[model samples]
Target: MVNFSLEGKIALVTGASYGIGFALAKGFAEAGATIVFNDINQELVNKGLAAYEAEGIKAHGYICDVTDEDAVNALVAQIEKEVGVIDILVNNAGIIKRIPMIEMSAKDFRQVIDIDLNGPFIVSKAVIPSMIKKGHGKIINICSMMSELGRETVSAYAAAKGGLKMLTRNIASEYGEYNIQCNGLGPGYIETPQTAPIRTPGHPFNEFIISKTPAARWGTPEDLMGPAVFLASDASNFVNGHVLYVDGGILAYIGKQPK
Candidate 1:
């Protein structure tokens, strides 16, 4: 039998209070891995814990910022003490600013880069040591379609995600010998709370996304569950430094001809 089970694994997903991260963490729990998550503050952590509990999963939650190296280190230590050495890490914490490039301040750009790019770097560094000792590890960075394609008003996000793609590859290259696999999960046009407004019927962005996507609809958070599980499990042991784009085939298709 192909071994896809994570019966004795521990998974830590950053910013799993809701949305894609929550869905992925829940999937891990369903796969029999012990689930741990973190948020930036106590409030969000509490909320995430409650949400996980609501799903009948006793997820361990903590308050930590992935951008802070010391905090991330401490968080890993605490998880190791409380739950177990992390077997899987999902770098799902990120933020995006929608201001046009020209109008956007450098401070704002750096903030996005710090959170989206640097956060993963910090967290991954913290966990790799334990993983090295354990002889195997899986790190999944939640990259975006912006990692490959550019768009208007999201200069910083695109740049950070682009950097993250390279970071994912570099980690795999440097750590593959240690039996570690680093990969990226690229989500495209997901329908989340943040995107709910734009998805309203007849919205230009919605129409644009639909037309661009061969699937003809925005992807749901649930759509990523299987991919998340695969990347986290032994199933993808040989798959390293790859960015699996769950974009409903948008990247491959050009678009329908304008009527």
Candidate 2:
């Protein structure tokens, strides 16, 4: 028995195919929010839909690249007209490219920025009008540990996520009077498909990460579900413009060096 409930709210989650997005969507469903899942991969979307349906959750999947403005606008319009007003929006679609700063090309940088940063802007712009019309909403942006702590090969990703933190705050300040709450979740190296390859012993950054993370372990997608549920539900009605770190206390350390 949970204290939080989104009994009649509708949620729109981007990047719902796998990883944190999927977990957050399912969590919202369990809390009674009708889920509208979007991902670029149709097959994975179908898989998610099936998984949710098997659980008897009200979930639907749509194929849309969150970076495309027109497509995002159309998708949101369709949802508003055909589905229902989205009371919650989770901008979780993002991509990462690991390369030395010297070797990182403008194209590569833009590619990362497009998916991680621009996509959120596009999707949030499209959905917020509906939220504003309703005079209440919740927006959660999935940031990263890099949002605050900079890293070597992930400059673009870090910049984008850092920008998202401010964007969340800015939006929250702008709409707080209208009852719209905007917040960000900065996840550490979670043991999902996204971070699995990087979690191996031989991976150069693995030991360093473990040493830095006070918890001495990588986080999982499930670790984030509770936070997402709190932010999406009425439990966090007064919480806004905050970036909650779910990083195994990694950010608290001075560096990767263990004490």
Which 10-residue span in candidate 1 carries the lowest summed lDDT? 1-10
**How far in Å is the alpha carbon of 259 misplaced in model 2?**
8.4
lDDT of 1 by residue, 148-187 (tens): 9999999999999999999999999999999999999999
Query: lDDT: which candidate is best?
Result: 1
Q: Candidate 1 — what's its lDDT? A: 0.96
| Candidate 1 backbone collisions, by pair | none
Predictions in order: lDDT = 0.96, 0.87
Backbone clashes under 3 angstroms, per model: 0, 0
List residue ranges in candidate 1 displaced over 4 A: none
Report the C-alpha lDDT of model 2 over 98-162, residue by residue, as the tens digit. 89988999999999999998898898888888888898899999988888978789989998999
C-alpha lDDT of candidate 2 relative to the true structure: 0.87
| Clashing pairs for predicted structure model 2, backbone only | none
